[model samples]
Target: MQQLQILSGSWEQFAQDAKLIREQVFIQEQQIAAEDEWDSEDAVSLHFIAYDQGQAIATARLLENNSIGRVAVLKEYRGQGVGRVLMQSIIQLAQQQGRSFVKLSSQVHALPFYASLGFIAEGEEYLDCGIPHMDMRLCF
Candidate 1:
């Protein structure tokens, strides 16, 4: 297996890998409702991407105030620790910026995954993109 490389970028200047993962995971496969997938907030957020031999394998975005979203790993790469590494990186970035909390809305199927990483479910499940989701948070 090829080693994965991670890069951090501002939304205004994300790399090809970042764009690729977003297109595949959010747009094509998940059909995340275009309206919910994008917002004016991206203009000031930080984006990260994991690349294996130059191919995008994972991605996530962390906005100011530590709100995390759009976290995804290609289906073929899911469960390989790629998502963990990406989340850890984003969490670290949040801390380095003096942020004390990070929050995310995770799909119901992925609740256990985030829970294992210390994100606690804080609200009732609701429909998102035709799938159930819940608000979650992790505070330092």
Candidate 2:
């Protein structure tokens, strides 16, 4: 068995693992600047890490206002359900916290994927950190 694990906690606790995945997917691979990739929000957000066979393969974060962001899955793991699992975990956590909605700014190319997960696109597409993105929301 691959023994996939989905762990959630403070950024401080899993910074190492989360950083590895995020830096690879966002910073290095996607050309996002290092400073833009690491932000102060991490200190306040809840982080989720997906590990496959003990190797970190995906990560995401949910903020206090139910804003979900920083979702990144290593290239090799895309389309394998890792991103879906991470989003579902975040949604379940928000519902457990009595939140009525969850929002995220998704990269333009990823809009369909988020939409498939029930998130609706709102407002016009705009640039964020040099990447075209759109604001999306899901209501519980």
Q: Write the per-residue lDDT of candidate 2 for residues 43-67, one digit (tens) a residue.
A: 9999999889888899999998789
The per-model lDDT (C-alpha) reads 0.85, 0.91
Q: What is the lDDT of residue 75 in candidate 2?
A: 94
The TM-score obtained by model 2 is 0.96
In angstroms, how far off is 19's CA in candidate 2?
0.5
Among the numbered candidates, top TM-score falls to 2
- Model 2 weakest lDDT span, ten residues long: 1-10
Candidate 1 lDDT over 1-140, as tens digits, reads: 47778898887677466667777888889887667777887778788888889887888888876789889899899878899888988888788888889999999989998999899999699987787999999998
Error of 1 at 91 (Å): 1.0
What's the distance in Å from true for residue 23, model 1?
2.0
Candidate 2 Cα lDDT to native: 0.91
